[model samples]
Target: MNEVAVVKNQILDVEISDLINNGMGLVKINGYPIFVKNALPEEKVQIKITEVKKTYALAEVLVIYQTNPYRVTPKCKIYDQCGGCNLQHLSYKYQLMMKTNFVKEALVRIGKLDVKVNDCIGMQDCWKYRNKTQVPFGVRNNKVIAGFYKENTHEIINMDTCEIQDALADEIVNYMKFLAQKYSIPIYNETEHKGNLRHIIIRKAHVTKEYMVTLVTKEDKLKNENKIIDDLVNKFPQIKSIVQNINPQKTNTILGDKQKVLYGDEYIIDYIGDVKFAISSKSFYQVNPIQTKVLYDQVLKYAELTGNETVIDAYCGIGTIGLYLAQKAKAIYGVEIVSDAIKDAKLNAKLNNFNNAHYEVGKAEDIIKKWQKENIKADLIIVDPPRKGCDSSLLDTIKTMKIPHMIYVSCDPATLARDLNILSDTFNIIEVQPVDMFPHTSHVETVVLMSRK
Candidate 1:
């Protein structure tokens, strides 16, 4: 519990020994860990301490004396400042290797369970893979600016394009920015919380080429709504839907309860492996469509359905996973807390003629408990929880229910490892597959299959 002997503004030369979870490199001085931004492992770099905490300190890389062979020049112009893509400086091949190692390390160090983690499945064309883009609107120097925020701050980093986002999204955002400026649409002010426009969220279907534009605003109305819609429809012929979301609050949260359809339908159709989905303005569809199919296919494989088992999908947002597995299972029961997503899920199930798939609006744990009390049994359970991993109550229910098979799709390796350790007592870890859903970033999606012992 002793404080590290590090002070602010101190300069020291250190060799990066490892990369941490947040994509920062780690170096130890007197056995005290110091995190250096934009530093690579096995590279010796000169770092300047910015802040010193009780146990660890944060530093910025000043100069790289020795560069790792995997290091590459970042393609982004504001790579040093923008926090959107963290591992762009590292080679794509090494980025996959590092992400695989990150999962393995989390399992071994945190879960204390040594398991074989497969090599990360990367996309052939990693760049321009994102199907969605949500850019905030802000004003800097009396001019409208729209882009991702800077690292660890709300300050917008003005940019023309993003490497990962779909090209159409970039075009739509830029065009919206131009129209906003020309029409004198006021940008939202986070400080005073008084403005008109807040964010521009664009979602594109990779296979369909259909586009949905959602203009997030402070109030329910836009200044020149009709003219703006006319201009947008005239320019973007591929735009299938245009909507306005009103967030009349003083908080930083995007999207509000009220929404109005400006033009076209309220939803845009998208597909993943022949499974159609209706994506609304606030739908929780995957950003990477290609890799999403890969991830879902892996889950289906791990489920090992033999066409007679009943499967339960927890946190089944929009019922994508359950609907994907519906053909293989006898019956699929999906549960989600969000009512909007549940509504979409039910609609999607009917759209696809999936009569066996049923969706309900409720917490996964509470619904599962109710099902268990009603003598409904799940042969297999699919959990695609958020970064915090499965809730303890859900874990307990799964353990008590003794589901034969469990497929866990995790976005955070640390939490997945922790949850896996807790469940290891009853289930045997069969295999772990890491998928590079978000390339050029430290975040990885892992699919783990566990069978009851």
Candidate 2:
């Protein structure tokens, strides 16, 4: 084993060599790796060791003698306190570069694939692009405070606005906080597991300019529901849905199984290109609608559908991607584990007036095999899975099916690499395109086109 050169709480000066996936700077002391927060590559900084593990030590910047050229002042006042946007200090150009590099490095190091990654596609106007905002409500010093949670803790960093969230949504969040105070609504305490209101979630449809507010509470009953609805609707004439979600459990999950419509409709309408989606409080629509179209357009370009090919959409939530491509394909079959999402998918298909779209509720791994047994083949398969990536059984099923063309949409590069490595035996990667779906953050979205060998 290598000798340790740093001790906990020890202050030392080091030159940063590179940045890790989470935007932390990495430095080496006697060939031992140390991670320093807020330190940039090629920079010299004084840091105090906060933690020392077997192979690595964690540190925080004390003073920076040299800084990277791309570093900039963070826009958010609580950029260091709030954990929402980590790369705000990095210039937008460098943020795109870092995300592209993240995908390329993950492919080579984790997936062991020799593939070229394209530069990340960025938005012209990245701020105020998020269509959804979920903020937890807490009472600090007998006053209601709402915003993002502080880093590494449940403490709330109260803010009136966020750089990435929609401006109107931020306004609605502040209004809700005001109403909570006016009505004396008890804020849920995670420790004591008491109180009434827990979180305030706001959603906006960029295309339709409609809004939805969902109040997550520890109980079904709400204080001054009528006045709250009347005041919010009167204040924001764009609001189309006012909802209350009952989350009686003492857990950390935000939404509950039961939801009630306090006023207006239960859902709001949104559009990506020509395809429309009905977004409920529980729907899994992308937060950034403008970039969602860009990502989907990339998928469409890769698919090159001829309007006569069967397309299988796996892990299809609300039929967003599949429905986007439905008009170009002969038929679309979508499978999801959530029955509600499948129902929404079917509803969205109807909303789009696409008769060729079919949806079923089941695991993708199991459904694909069932389709194979029924001799229902797909000319193209698209999988947009969670961060954990595709199930091993699903990958094996894809291998057995040997679909001619496939597209992998991933939010996590590491998992995308692992799955691509497994599929490499049967598919040849044509290209990879990363989209800046969430700006000023370490997260990235990638689309890969693969052809069966």
Candidate 3:
């Protein structure tokens, strides 16, 4: 990577490749794809090349002397540092437009499908939409450090307050510092591989207005466990649940092992629409509640399941969407790969008292095949896969089964486009709706409704 002086370089006018999704502008400078971060299309500005390679150059916004009308001041101080939200600097309406174009670009470039995507479904409040946040702790400057790292770097930027997360979440960080100082629990160190605190994942229930604080660290790290849990429960009665996770490994992953409940309920319960779900620390619940409600409603509306139609919810975690629509359908079968998630889903079904909804613990594709062998037929199927999106085998199974109505919820549009290209022969895309699940970032969640001809 060579250092190129972009500001004073006497180069010709560089034409942007338009918004190539992810809120980045592409330009083939020197026959290489130069990715300019925080850049807008059709807008010319001098950029500072941070890293110049033979193929592409990574740059930062140096002199946007000419600003686009869509650009707005970033509300969060950690806008450029924390990778949590990228589009916050841009206006809400502009954010909506950028996301709308993102989906359109994916369809045109990746899927090669001439599909008409509607305007992105915007949220009521983009900030403070997150109901949960997992703040990581790493050692830096010779002590415990708490904050998010710079984008694409291991360096952590200490933040006094995070605008994207709820104000209570910010307070929790400060409160934990007081307790950590009082209890003398050392924070985790990535370089030296020594420290006590690893992560603090705070879960908030919207309806209940209760909070669940789960402290994750080594099993034997907490010296005075009972006293601390008692102190937390007593001090913060609103803290409905407290959990201690034992994870001794060295990884940046989320889940932990051997959770020991210190106080309050075992799991936190929350509602989405009309259905209630049991949420564990490891459960993959939607981070944004406002947009998730819209996402699920769109799923049900697209399904159009009659009271007599049977619905199958593949990859249903905790049965949030499936259980809500269970009563409308004749029978709802929810399949999940994680057994713990399946257990919680079953409990949620029991909690909702919906005898029509059933949950099975197995891979989405594997369980669907097994159910096919058991002579199971579904009139409607809804799949909300992880970020990597659904695989070919799953799409192939859907095509072979020929499900009449299919609603696919995807967080990654590139993979969604790839899968849609594969399923285009049998199904005509009726409509595609982009949901603003994550408002600040370039990432957008899309729901594609397809009906078989």
Candidate 4:
């Protein structure tokens, strides 16, 4: 083991060797690595040690002796303080390359699989692509402000516009802040657990141009609720739905179980390709609908539907993917744990007039077993688990079922590799496609196709 050489506040000039998944630069001193922020690979930088640990240390870039050619000024003014976009300084071209490498590295290092990873599919226009914006409300200088929280802290960054979010969303957030101040809406304090409003969420449908606003609060009673709702509707006629989600608990979760539709319908409509969906306050739809089509197109291509195969969609949120593939398949059975999502999924299926799609609300692993007992045979199975990846039991069930073909969609590369390693014994890796769902951020979405050998 190497002895600790770097101390707190120690300054040193180092050459960055590589970039980690979080876009942090790797600097080695005496065989020990230090992670530096705002530093790029192949650049010489002077850094100050922020924190030191046994194996690794954390650093902040003090001065760049030599900067990378791809580095550019961040577009957002609050990019340094706000923690939303991590790769704004890096060029979008290199950002795609880095995300491709992120997926390739995970497959080789974590999954122990030597496979070829295709280049990441990116958007032509990445800015202002996000359809949903959720900003926390806080009291700054005795006035209400709304924006994203600082990195690893609860303090909100007061900003009127975000480059990545829809322009209309920015206008709505600023106006809502003004309305909150006028109405004297109380801002919730995590420490004291007082006040009424906690956060404001706005979701816009890119295809339909329809919008939905959800206010998260500590209580149901709001000051001048009718006036505020009326003012918002009149100000933004595109806003078809306004909802209030009540979360009286003192926790970090954003939305509560109980909700009330303040004005208009409870759900708004959105489309992915030809499939239409009714998105509610809690439904888990993809933020980037443009790249989502590209991603699902890859899934459909890999599935190679011939109108004879029965498909199963595990972790299907609102039956988006299954419904997207429902046209060419014999039947589609989708399972999700969220009851609200299941309700939306059923509603979306009906909206699209697809009677072949079936949705169930339960743990996918348990539901798969029940389906297996009922002699429900599926030709293909698709699992799009969360960042934590699929459950071990669910993987075991998939292996046991011996599904001929499988498609695994993942948002986290590390977890995707772990789950793929478990399924490698029974499935042969066919192809891995990386999609740049969230630009100017470290997150990447991947879709992998596997076949029974």
lDDT of 4 by residue, 142-220 (tens): 9889998898898889989999999999999999999999988888988899999999999998799999999999998
- List model 2 lDDT by residue over 62-174, tens digit each: 99998899999999989999989888989999999999999999999999998999999999998988998999999888889999889889989999989999888898899
lDDT of each: 0.92, 0.93, 0.79, 0.93
Output the better candidate (1/2) by lDDT. Answer: 2
Task: Name the weakest run of 10 consecutive residues (lDDT summed) in model 4.
Answer: 1-10
lDDT of 3 by residue, 389-446 (tens): 8877888888888688888888888888888888899899999999988877888899
Candidate 3 wrong stretches, greater than 4 Å = 1-17, 139-144
Query: What is the lDDT, from 0 to 100, of the residue 213 in candidate 3?
Result: 91
TM-score of each: 0.98, 0.98, 0.93, 0.98
RMSD of 2: 1.1
Pairs with steric clashes in candidate 3:
87-440, 186-196
Residue-level lDDT of model 1, residues 1-453, one tens digit each, is: 655968999999889999987889998877889999999999999999999998999999999999999999988888888999999989999999999999999999999999999999999999999999999998878888899899899999987899999988898898998899999998889889888899999999888999999999998879999999999989999999999999999887898899999999999998888888999999899899999999999998888888998999999999999999888899999999999999999999998988998887988989999989988889999999989998999999999997899999999999999999999999999999999999998999999999999
